[model samples]
Target chain A: MPFVTFLDYAGVAVFAATGALAASRKELDIIGFLFLASVTGIGGGTFRDLILGIPVFWVINRDYVWICASVAVLVFLTAHRFESRYKLLLWLDAVGISAFSVMGAAKGLVVTGSVSVAIITGMLTATFGGILRDLLAGEPSVLLRPEIYVTATLIGAAVYTGADIAGLAPLLASILGFVAAFIVRGGALRFGWTFPAYKGRPGRHPDDIP
Target chain B: MPFVTFLDYAGVAVFAATGALAASRKELDIIGFLFLASVTGIGGGTFRDLILGIPVFWVINRDYVWICASVAVLVFLTAHRFESRYKLLLWLDAVGISAFSVMGAAKGLVVTGSVSVAIITGMLTATFGGILRDLLAGEPSVLLRPEIYVTATLIGAAVYTGADIAGLAPLLASILGFVAAFIVRGGALRFGWTFPAYKGRPGRHPDDIP
Candidate 1:
């Protein structure tokens, strides 16, 4: 595989593992784990493609699906042994998120020719899948949290776009974007940094249950 | 309100109610119910628009959001009494489904000018919300069920396309499509008719699940 393909596969594995872990937290069965993993691995790219009016990438290329499945299976088999090792999981997720964020921005810029849209797409591509996983798992989505999830991705997207405009090679731009996102996310985690919550009100709840 | 707006509001209400019922079955809290109801109300249309490369309709149109919220709250309050007395929820759902199916097709056709694509969009718009609700509710998605769900929508889409091609008025074509879908779906439900399931075929999982 070429460098891009190799890195993309690695990112897929990490993201799929994150999905498997989320399913395990919810005590879902193996099938649920696989489904979650596949969605997390491909969700960002699908959103990008859908917005770009391109055919969804995974639907056209089966390799991504195959990798997701394999990773889910591997994670399921070895998950118990790694149950206590949460730091490693978080780091893996950070790496995958950073890489995917840059990749998403690059794809968006190439397809749409709009830097602002590319930035938004990059952030969405990085966080949307995890958000879905969290929502389905009945947790507060990262988007709703005070954490610097999308902010880190936005910074990375800006950096990547700027680098590309300055005539940097795509490979170099991607590597720098990935590093930028990873560092910001890691710093946020280390320092317990967060965005502002509405001073006191998280907003009133709607009356009546679903 | 225009006739189209009336139908659209009614459709939103019905879908929101359906979403509430699904969320109730899953025992979601009030906020979660709101979330599901909102998604169920707008989810399918959003998917269709996204695929067609448009800004999401709800984000652009505020009325859709308010109508769905109102309907969800009303249904949450009145479900037990209303469900027991009239037994009309099923009828209302069928009507809503048919109308939305036609509208979905019309919108897609107007945007893409492709009959096949319009039919697919119609089916998606009619059914995708239900799928989202089912998935989040941890129930099997309707798409995976051996059912004639898409078939009913397909008939409506074809009728609408044919009527439009023959120079029929848009309103008349829409009504014809809606009625065609309503009949097919109503018949299927009344007779407990469903599609044939694949026993030994593609997309089959291994026999490890219970």
Candidate 2:
């Protein structure tokens, strides 16, 4: 349980770093960086906890906020040195999604005892943060992209939920889930893997519809 | 209490109608309309309940989802007949924000007993649904629009919280809050009221920095 907690914090920190980097790109102030980082770090877990009808993870414990703030400040000061902050962000996000997806699934399984909800919570926890980050920052949303982002999280979540339901040890199940997510996301980053974009057929004219 | 519940359902229906209309503008199918409507209807309250550490209302009742779905279907069938769906959407949104802001503040006060939190929850409840709808529908977010949206919600929430704290009757306080929100939003819609947007200074060039 302590180890899982560590993974959660690690995931938060990595996500916060990405958020700060995003703010840096936008030339947002320190306060903006802190706000973005904190939201991106905790937003996913908050959504998952809410859906599970549990106390929000950050409300009871101030540590998560501090961690996000610290990561924000750190990234704010150091991000200018990086030649390719976008690449760094993608890698960090992959790590975050890997850790968070498994942890979210575990928490969902514990709370709901439903495999479907567990997998969904995992996907929500992994992707909602980035989605919020993009929306708030006025950047193009990750969901709009054709890349395999949520798909990676979904696969990892399903794997973890399946493993736990099948009586696999918790730690082993987590590792398998994390590796699966990371591999898929990493492949997308490295080789530009993507699902085919949806192409809607032309709509009938209103006059022709009748 | 029953009256407040009625207000909540009414607010949800109005919000869902706007969401479905947005889908119509985008030429989305019925399923897309349903998805957008449901999210726009319950998203804010869901956020409120989660933040308050209470069970999500829709998860417990299911009636909220039914309301959203039903509204979506109605809007899908009837929206094309409207001459200016955007105008109707704006007016309905105003009504929604008015009712939801007061109700959200009332819920927050009852649960947390914090005036500031109550006001914040009210604003979140009023605006978050619209934000989610715009994000999902790939439309320009209302938050990005300079019109006095959240400001109106804030005023309404503060008024309700102040009235409740000052020993005003619940029904009277809610009416005052709702009226305040609607008037402000109505003014914005009629007159195009807006707050001045932020304009950041040019950053120091890295190479020129000592």
Place model 1 in a CAPRI quality band: incorrect
Q: Which candidate number maximizes DockQ?
A: 2
Q: Candidate 2 — which residues are off by over 4 angstroms?
A: A1-38, A48-53, A58-128, A141-210, B1-3, B29-32, B59-66, B201-210
TM-score per candidate, chains pooled: 0.56, 0.61
True contacts kept of each: 0.03, 0.08
RMSD of 1: 9.8
Residues B146-182, candidate 2, lDDT per residue (tens digit)?
Answer: 5667678878899989999999888888888889989
State residue B13's C-alpha deviation in candidate 2, in Å: 1.2
Question: Each candidate's root-mean-square deviation in Å?
Answer: 9.8, 7.6
Model 2, position A131, has a per-residue lDDT of 89
